[model samples]
Target: MSMNSHAAIAPSLLARIGAPVRRRAAFLLLMASLGLGVLREAALGDAWRRPVRAEFRRVLREAAGGGFSTIAVTAALIGLGLVSQAIYWLGEAGQEGIVGTVLVTVLVRELAPVLVGFVLLGRSGMVAIVELGAMQAGGQLRALQGMGLDPFRLLVLPRVAAFAVTGFTLGIIFVLIALLTGFVAGSLLGVVQLSLFGFLDAVLRAMGARDFLLFPGKLVMIGALVGLTSTITGLSARRGDSTATLLPRGFLRGVLAVLLCSALLSLAV
Candidate 1:
């Protein structure tokens, strides 16, 4: 081939190779931008106008209040299984003194956020997807746009904020319930002799300043990601999509996003 022909083919070949990379990069950037936009709108008092506040209150109620029993039950089971097991094994190993640290580091710091994120995603995130997906599919989004409403500000922000708030609330409840249940179970089994106050004090003492900040941060971030991923997945649906297709995709993305956010936060700290 001539040098000019070689140059032409090389550029075309490079472009072909870079196509997927470019697309992936663009998707990541878009997600990051949307996340920031949510944060910015959340910070603004004007974003809490009556309609937005009403929607936010409704979602928060549905996501957090409606799911309280389930969260409590799950936390109890986690306490019975994980906490009891940990107490037993640690006691047997003569490492009982470190029970609080272990629980703080493993159960509260890590598992609580992840499990709460999953719960929120399964309970509320899927609802957001189905609701938004139906609207998008039925052309309601177009109607809203025609009426001069910004869908992101109206629909997306409130829902995402609800998820974040619910995540934090549920996470704290999960940790407390799990620990309390574990304490009860441990006492019944003769595995834990410490008073409730002593047990909690130990755990609190083991937590560092960073843990105080990072634990809640993880919950909030995971919640926000769950909301954001579900909303994006639903809103991006085509005319051909239905709830059947949207549910599994949104669930998978929400799970991956929760885990990704948790991992990233851990790495950051």
Candidate 2:
């Protein structure tokens, strides 16, 4: 083989090898971050606890104000889809009774968290990372340090708490709306018997205490993963000249981190 051909092949081969290693490293780092965050939360007792709690409250307030807008918009879109599916299934007879069950299970267990996380990733997480990156680049973080303020406490902590609370709350709301919309559509279509109690029973029976526990657990882990990964990636961006490349790479890493953490936790459950 010609040296030129070998060189080309080597680059492609190296790229293939590097991709998996990078993914694995990102997954490992995500797990480490989750472990470290959980440990810190446990060890600090009330020192960081009050601030985190306060930040979470603040986040909920902000989300209550602004999160509604996004939730409303998402609800409309999701409601339409759920309703359409319910109507279609209702035409098939007794399957309509399960519409509410399907909606709740899919929305609460899967769609809501994943969708809300992705939305916040784009809406909140990206903005947070960029803003913090810019602040660090402009020496604001350093200025705060000089002013004797802890950047972690002032910046990272609140955002982390906010993301967890907001993401989880929005997820729950999304699921509720989806189920309700499905139920209404099923009733309107006159398929089977549309009883809220029956639907609730189905949902409750399908989702055990373990499932309920796991969903929130996954959400919290995903929230922390997004927060820490974004922070580290943004901080790293300060040292680089390529904000464009760094931002996308950071976003992808953050998402992958969330998925990895969720998958690992699922395995343990």
Candidate 3:
């Protein structure tokens, strides 16, 4: 075939391949756009007016409150399992001196953020997907626009911001509870001789500057992206999309976002 024929055939072939590819590409494109535009949208004069503020508050409460107990339980379980084992083994190996460093690196820098991200994703992110997706499918978003409301401003901004804030707050809570629980468990198991304060101090001192900066930032950004992916997935729902279709996609996308963000951020620091 001539080069021109090849070029012509390429377009036709691509057209056939584009449907599934384009849907994914569009979802990613929108997710990125929404993540970037959130702050800009929040800055708009009308973005955080009474209605938007109310929604933000409501979402913040729901996302944080719903996951609070889950985060606690998960953190405690991790403490009893991962943290206690690390402490016991390190003590056995006469590496108790590095306990802080290991825990900080594994728990704070890595496990806490990803685990907390999952907690937020499962607890509140799915809820947003369902609610927003239903609105999109029902044309309620367009209906709100027809009534002179900016759906992005009223809905997207508040929810995304709420999720971000909640992410950071819950992350701190998770770390503290996990560390405390682990200390208690270790002390009871006769594996840890250090006082609670000493253990906390050790963990704190083990933290380098990057840990302080990157960990919280990662959690915040992860939270924001969780909300972003969920909202975009939901808002992009096709007319006939049911929860069955929207949910799995939302979950997959959200999980991908969290893991990718965590990996990249860890690498960066």
Candidate 4:
């Protein structure tokens, strides 16, 4: 081949090779940008306008309220089985004094945050994927853009904020439900020797200063990560992409984000 032909083919080959890298770079760039937008909205009271507040409330209700039943059912099951088993085994082993420490370390600190993350990812995150993906695929996002409205500000910012709030609130609720149900089951099975308040108090005492930060931090970070993942996945949907394509992609991303972020936060803090 001639030098000119070689040059032309080389550029084409390089473009093909760099395509995945370029896509990744773009994804990270948008993720960082959207994260900053969410932080800005959170740190500034001025960012919460009437319409934004309205949108925030709407998403909050949908995310927290809509996912409550799922959270309750999961918590109850964990409590009935895992909590009861732990109590029975510890009592039998004559190490019941450390029940609080074991439960706090294993259940509250680790499991709760990750479970809450999964719940949010499965319930609210999927909904976000569907709604946002539909908007993108239908060209409605472009129509909104032409109308001089910022979809990122009006849609994404509010939704992410709601997710963060939902994460924290729902996490606390899950912990309470799980603990209560577990205590009741243990008591009925004659495995629990302490009163209800005493059992709860022991768990509270076992929690160190770090547990306080770890619990909320993991959930909030997980929530934000899941929110961003779902939004980006939905918005990235190509024109011809169907719901079948979008859902699996969004779900895979959300699950990975929740698990990875949960693990990272557990180690970092």
| lDDT scores of the candidates, listed in order | 0.90, 0.68, 0.91, 0.89
- Candidate order by lDDT, highest to lowest? 3, 1, 4, 2
Candidate 3 lDDT over 177-217, as tens digits, reads 88888888899999998988899999999999999999999
Q: Model 2, stretches more than 4 Å misplaced?
A: 1-35, 38-46, 49-64, 83-101, 240-243
Worst 10 residues of 1 by lDDT: 23-32
Best by TM-score: 3
Q: List the residue pairs that clash in candidate 2.
A: none
- Per-residue lDDT value at 264 in model 4: 82
Q: Write the per-residue lDDT of candidate 4 for residues 124-165, one digit (tens) a residue.
A: 998998999999988899999999878887788888889988
Candidate 4: stretches off by over 4 Å: 1-18
lDDT of 2 by residue, 1-269 (tens): 89999999999999999999997788568557655765575457563666566765665576445666687678667866865465466557656556545654566666666666766676667766787788878888889889987777656666776677777777777766766676676567665364777766766676767678878877776766676667666665646636686679768977786666666766677
In terms of lDDT, which candidate is strongest? 3
Each prediction's total of clashing residue pairs, residues at least 3 apart in sequence or on different chains, is 0, 0, 0, 0
lDDT of 1 at 119: 93
